[model samples]
Target: MGYSEEKLIEEKVFKDPVHRYVHVRDRVIWDLIGTKEFQRLRRIKQLGTTYLTFHGAEHSRFNHSLGVYEITRRIVDNAFASRPEWNEGERLLSLCAALLHDLGHGPFSHSFEKVFDLDHEDFTREIILGDTEVNQVLSRVAQDFPKKVAEVIEKTYENKLVISLISSQIDADRMDYLQRDAYFTGVSYGHFDMERILRVMRPREDQVVIKQSGMHAVEDYIMSRYQMYWQVYFHPVTRSAEVILTKILHRAKHLHEQNYTFKHKPHHFYSIFEDRMTLEDYLKLDEAVFLYYFQIWEEEEDEILSDLCRRFNNRNLFKYVEFDPAKEYKKLAKLSMLFEQAGLDPEYYLVVDSSSDLPYDFYRPGEEEERLPIHLLKKNGEIRELSRESDIVDAISGKRRTDHKLYFPSDFLEKEKARPEIEQIAQILELNLDNGTI
Candidate 1:
């Protein structure tokens, strides 16, 4: 039998918290899961730096990846199998795309990506198409199979139905992560009637639509996503930790550029620091590797680098206050100067971060990062965009909300407040009255 068609003598079942059981029967899937590249996900956390905030949020990407695969499998084999719109030939391709979509996420995910200008999606394509174990295993099915898998994950596959199953507004990836993250973190915000939504899904030529009967369940799902973003994902404490983490990366790179010698050489980070990190170099990185360097850098000679590393390791995160970027520009400038006078480097110690979200948006052409809107299928077989049919959805649709915060080392500012030289700046910030939290 061909590798793609080969089934295991017995189905392999993974007992999962979110999906209950991830059943694997195809030899191709079983082999791909055993590949070293996929195994590396076990060492990478699903929610980076979130464990510090939600202590139970220690689940790894390997767990979330398998949940995503299982959700896609259910949609393909259970919901859409007999539907005329779903091509049976695309089943394996969809499963592969769902499982490998997050294959290239680095340690600390977004924070690391921001500092180094790395795109995990770019690395994801490289891993599937380059000379790697994942590619080798995929090549066994067919010479072009690996490219097909990569294209599906990249949202460039010709099969629009397959792309929509993974990338659309309410797809398998988000479905898995929302419930999975909520389960691990013990939060109720990500909960919704997923089973009902899955049952009512109808496949279309270009996208997936929900049966009219399932509108309320879909509404619940949307609200769950909106709440999860503000309550759990964008928790202020989590952002503070991320701010410290980003500074550590920035300080290390700056030191590297200045020819600063390290007491403990950063062998794993040298390629990344040079911006020439190869596939091999990237594959060698995981959270454990980063923690090792951070542990040793605590004693490094560079005060900024060592201080930032110490703060991250010890959980001494910076405190923040509400900031308005448009109106508070002068206040921010004054704070930066005061931070410097108080023996804190404004670049490393004073920072501003913003978080924003669009609860739901309808299709808008010619806009950057255009997203496919959700559609609901009527009883007469006609389809309507979700917002048009549901009053609840229309209320918040197309609205964007944003928040900004100014972060600084309140401990240093408190000490400097009593000093005559920097007292004026400290009072301007009201550190003495509020103890630095707002």
Candidate 2:
């Protein structure tokens, strides 16, 4: 058998809580799973700092990657099999793309990316084309096979159908993460009829379309996404942990720039701090390495660094109140000045975090971050955008919802409540420090 056609002696099955069982048989996929770079996902989290709010959300990207591959397998092997629209030759390519889509996520994924100005998508492409175990496994199939997979992940592949299987708004990546994250977080909001959505999926010349019969299921999925964003993804407690984590990274980077000596030197972060991080330096980082530093940094000499690390390590997160930047810029300025007068570092202590989401959208080419909207195929073979066909989808189709919160160490302010500055800060925040109304 050719490299692409090879199959394992027996199927390898991983027991999964969300999908029941994720089976692997293709030789290329089996080998890719064994590669060290893929195994590294077991140590990285799927939802960074979310576990601080939802303790059960400790699952890793390994679990999610396998789930995505399994969903794609069901779609190709069951739904699209022998269909003239879906080329059988693209089966393995779709599977490979689905499996490796999130291959480059780092520890504390989003927060780390923000502080370092790093993009996981770029790192993912590098891992596939660079001199690495994943590259070697993919090269066995074809010299350009690694590049093909990278392009699919990059959404630049010529085959739009293959790209839709992973990159589309309703693709395998979102399907798997929504269900898997809901299961691990023990929340009811992420629950949707994924089985029905998978069954109704049809391959189009340029994108995936759903049968109109499955429009209700698709609506449920969209609403689930909306609820999850507010209930879990943007939970204030989770955002609090994220704020502290971001400050920790910023403090470390600043200290590195200041030539501050450390008892527990950040050897793993040196390359990143200097803005010269290589692939090897990146692959060496995981939650374990970061948590180790956080535990030890609690003892560092710098008060800000030590306090922040202590809070993260000990779950003493910051408290937050609703803040609207557009309507209350003056209020925010007053709070910042009062915080400074009370000896609190406004840069780290006073933080305004905003989260926004557009539940669904129709395709608009000129808009920023253009998304190919979900299309539904009617019984008469007419195709229409989902929002136009379904009232529930239309209600929130193009509307963008944004929320902002101002985070601070309320305990710090409470200790000095007798001071005039602290009193003014508490009044502005609508926080009664005397009675602990925060």
Candidate 3:
């Protein structure tokens, strides 16, 4: 629908939780969303295990994909389309890139990628460049339209303006997810004055820059990002579910490796177990299929598998203790031995989950895959980095903060409460047994 007269007769709309209404006008955008590959996003939850913690967080990637497109649409169409430097030819490419950005995310993407060493970006490129309906629909625009879309998503497009619009420290994708996720999770921290930010956004030679007047709004957005990472993204209960999910996959892989006969063979996981997951193999595995397997594994002969499956299905999550890995290595080692002695495989049972956040972090002179910094353009046309212009963001500029948690089954420990080793483990961590917590 680029530079053409064959546009949709009427615009379509989707009622969105964050943006209110997501408007769609391009025929190409409509067709790409209808592709079977894109529709698969409907089955994959946006926050994976977070739904276990926030019941309202049942929204899927499809919900987020549409939100991203809507944000980008507003930014491109209203914010920068009429600018002298804005290239009209790149409009469709930007829309397509935003729409298909997360098309390759697998079921429980973070856990799947961590366990299987799969890069969703690689698959995103493959899906767009390979033999698929997404590619076919994108190709209808032009022979090289798919490649252009891929380039934008990959952040390798010659047009820095396009890349910055989608992948910057503050961009449509992040903007959409922050509010969308907060809305679904029933949190109030992610709200920011996005309308003002858009009004003040200007395209620079190298990136998107905000007017100095909107600096306060940009700072608010940064603080909101920091809060969400701590409050929502790094919730202990969600990570507990992730730990159990990871162990389930690990136990299944181990069983397959040892030639342990499963009552219900996990044919769906064969390719993943071998580390040779094809696109078809990846597509076959969704949240539903995973739940199906977890249900069946609950009855498997192996105690580890059966127990973990039941734990995940019943929300019997592992209890965690705030741990300092640097100072508690020996304590952790002793706990592992105690877990093994208690008949809980330390490898699968004792999980150390770490989450790190770099608030207001941006691209350095020489850093790998560095994110471009947010800039505020002054009234006199001079620009300054966001940290220099905002006191709040400056407080923790580019500093990485980390939290480590030790997750294990408290029920298992309580069952062996009388054991000397279990008592020692509790004493080592100074467990608050009176309150039934660590």
Candidate 4:
């Protein structure tokens, strides 16, 4: 007997601030969410340490997973309903792909990746295809259904419509996160007319395109992305938290390598430290487990590990100021020496965080890693690349922006005795203590 496409006896809705209501009708998605793995998302923060900067961003991946599913449902309904271009057979596949996209993301995903040399995307694929509850549910649909969903995530699905629904230049994932993050962070910068964008979206051969009249709407999205990148995504204070978290992981791993015995074993981190994490172990981890370890590690005999853990837990994020990377290396070295003299381990205390991103891009012929350029369908049925038709997108397209900030603990230096030396270090870093300039 084949797996039946059954709807829940009673429809379920998750009250989401961004999407308002995330509706679940299908039994499979409901079952998957109820599984232990999906519930773990509640413990994993959606924004990592951004919660330290934007307190309301304490929402979890469970919140975001539902948002993604809601966005995917809306997009599929709006764009693919009664349309010949979209295969109705792929609707469930698209929703499943969206819901499970971030399932493999670890606690503090990017920082964990940097310290452990791991890729969340690879882990995401593994989770969907491995012996997970997700894999079992998907396999029940068809023996190869799990592979199809995984392929959609990997952008190699034979069904381009399925692929586009989850991962186009302006797809459901970006659409949801922009509005959801903006709402949670109370930042209006990420807002755009989502209904307008969805209304104009049209699926076509192997991709999705917008109607020509929606050009301005697309421009709004591009600009919103630009502002969000600077104002939220790359905020220095958020990066400061990241710096502290990274150093914490580094110190712990270093101690582990030196055969040091932790007063409390960081068992959840064992797979990460050894670089052989199975999907099962990975699924067991989330931010709460990490936070639990952090709370316990605050009392460890290791000064560096304990301090870094305390700093992360208490939101004592490092202070940051803009730096001229080309000319600042020498001065930075002297500051490191000063930190060492103060009995602070410069290796764990001083950090330079540099981040760069291109919020929007235009397609270039023969480019190796070109973005799937957004297209607008004309009345005459011709398709035009977004930047070619919209000046706003053209202005920012392919323009890469970079930001660098040097981070340190200003509070530690604010004490009366440390004030003079702290001022000296601040001056060397070209920081404006009075104005909070960075």
Candidate 5:
């Protein structure tokens, strides 16, 4: 149904833990959600292997999709409903962009992207504009409707207000994911005054800005982002899982390149290795399919592949200790030789995981690709960048924090004969032997 005239006879509601309730009033949004492509997100974990570390984080991308749609709905109705700066005609575009933003995300999104050199953003655009149910649904609104939605998602839509609602620093997408992720992970750090923030959010000439009164809420939001980055997003154990998964794919590709016969054909991964996957083939993949492959790969003839698959499946994650990259590289290189002496291939057995993030930053004068700085609307009608007005934001602005860890299978080192060398290496690295060391 085109925007000209279409309405659902009854409203639909999804009980969401983060948003409480996700409401659907339009038949088009409802139909789009029911499509096979959209339903596939139900089988994909939003945080991927992070669930292995945070047991409560089992929520799916489908849950997040609804949360995002709900957030967008609220922003439209509560924040911009009667505002002259916000065009009522752009409501559907905003909703569509929010609902379908992560549509092209494959299983274990970032890890998959690293292993396969695939860009989820490109695929997202393709899914919205390609020959599929999503494209067909958008086309029903108008011949150019799909392109319009794509432009909004790409942040190139002529309507700057509409683009900002979905893509801004404090927009609905980030607001939904942070709160939703925190809810699923059972962590309190992600909680912020979303209601207060939304209430104070007003449309400016070409973008959205928070009122001066909501500056604290914005600071809290930034702090929440900082904590989530350190505690959940860049957790070393999660990165260990990622490292192992990446190695597994690398090993599989290596084996295939060497013409080693696989006991079970990796049909799903064939196109991935060849870099020729069609949208249809990519859509067929989800966490379930990948997990199934891992289960089968555990019995593979290759020891490295089999071991990695087993570790990933059983959650026997690599043990890690803090490492100083600049000072420890030479020592780490020597440790690799020691591992080789002990018959463990350092390439597959030892991993260095480094995670870095910028919690907040101010706009640099000539920075090529800087974020649109968060602006606060003062009581006197003057706009000031957040860090300029808030001490907390100022303290952390443009500051980047990073962590480095060295991961290895400590259980392998426990073998009686290898214990001495392992202990010596651990001592040399000044690794903590306490329970929290891992």
Candidate 6:
């Protein structure tokens, strides 16, 4: 038998703060949401370490996942369900792909991925195609349905139109996360006309495009993304917290490699340290699982691991100063030496982090893995890339901006002001100790 097209006798609704009501009609989606693997998302924070900086960012990935699914549902069911340019057959595929896109994200996904050299997308594919309950449900739809959903997430699907709906510049994932993150962070940067943008979205032969009339809304979205990237996503304090997180994981991994006994071993992280994270082991980790270890590790005999865990758990994050790696290598080296002299290990105490993004870009042919540019569909049945037509988009299109910051435990140096090296290091780093200014 083919995949079931069964619809629920009545829809289920999740009262979301961002989307208001996330409606679910298809039984497959409902069952997928109820699966153990999908339920695991509720335990992972949407913004990871951002909550330490912005107390309001305590929302979970499950919340953002539902919001993404709801937005994609609106686009497919409302805007294109009756349109000939869109394939009605791919509706479930798009919805499922959107819902499960972030399923593989571990606790503190970015730092975890970096320290362990892992990809959440790879885990996402594994979960959907493996022996998990999610795979079982998808296989019932037809043995290949899960693969279709996975491909959409992977951006390797033959249907470019479907891939763009979830992965493009102005796709449902960004549309949901921007508004949802803004609402949770209590910031104004991520707010834009998602509703109007959705209303203007049209599926083309190759991809989804917005009507030219909605160009202003699209411009606002691009600008909103730019603002949020700097203000919220790239906040230095948040990065400071992330630095500590990355260091904590690295320290734990190093200690494990040396066979140094951890007073409280990270049983959940064993597979990760060995660079062989099975799907079962991956599913066992979440923020709570990490936090439990952090709390316990705070009492460990190792000063570095204990201090970092206490900092992360107690919100005693490192302080950061503006840094340019190309020009500030000497400054970083000098600070490292000072930290070592001050009895702080420079390997764990001193760190540099960078955040960068291109606000928008039009497609460049033959560019491997470049973004698919935003398009504006004209009334005359013509198509134009956004930067070619919009002044606002053109202004920043193809421009990549990067910001770097150096993170260090200020308290470590401040505790002993009698040491002249601390002052010299502070002077070189150009920090305002009075106000913790960079």
Q: Record all residue pairs in model 3 with backbone atoms less than 3 Å apart, i.e. clashing.
A: none
Off by over 4 Å in 1: 356-369, 433-438
Q: Model 3, 24-45: lDDT tens per residue?
A: 8889888889998999999999
Which predicted model would earn the best lDDT? 2
lDDT for predicted candidate 2 compared with the true structure: 0.90
Model 6, runs deviating above 4 Å: 1-3, 356-369, 432-438
User: What ranking of all candidate models by lDDT puts the best one first?
Assistant: 2, 1, 6, 3, 5, 4
Clashing pairs in 6: none
Error of 4 at 213 (Å): 0.9
lDDT of each: 0.86, 0.90, 0.85, 0.81, 0.82, 0.86
TM-score to native of every candidate shown:
0.95, 0.97, 0.95, 0.92, 0.93, 0.95
State residue 392's C-alpha deviation in candidate 1, in Å. 1.7
Residue-level lDDT tens digits of model 5 in 221-266: 8787767777887777788888888888889988888989999999
Which 10-residue window in model 5 sums to the lowest lDDT?
357-366
Q: Provide backbone clash counts, one per model.
A: 0, 0, 0, 0, 0, 0
Which model, 3 or 4, shows the larger lDDT?
3
Query: Could you list the CA RMSD of all candidates, in the order they appear?
Result: 2.3, 2.0, 2.3, 2.8, 2.6, 2.4
lDDT of candidate 6? 0.86
For candidate 4, lDDT tens digit of each residue in 1-438?
235378888999988788778999888889889877778888888788888888888878888888888888888877569888877778889989999888888898878878888778888898888878888898888889889888998999998877887787788888887778888899989899988988898888788899999989889988887788778778788888888888989988998888899998888878777777788788777787888988999999999889899999998788877777887777887898777776677888888777742122222221354557788899999998888888777778657666677787776655423356667776676655664443
Clashing pairs in 1: none
Better of 4 and 6 by TM-score: 6
lDDT of 4 at 231: 81
Candidates by TM-score, descending order: 2, 1, 3, 6, 5, 4
- What is the Cα-based TM-score of model 3? 0.95
How close to the true structure is residue 167 of candidate 6, measured as C-alpha lDDT?
Answer: 87
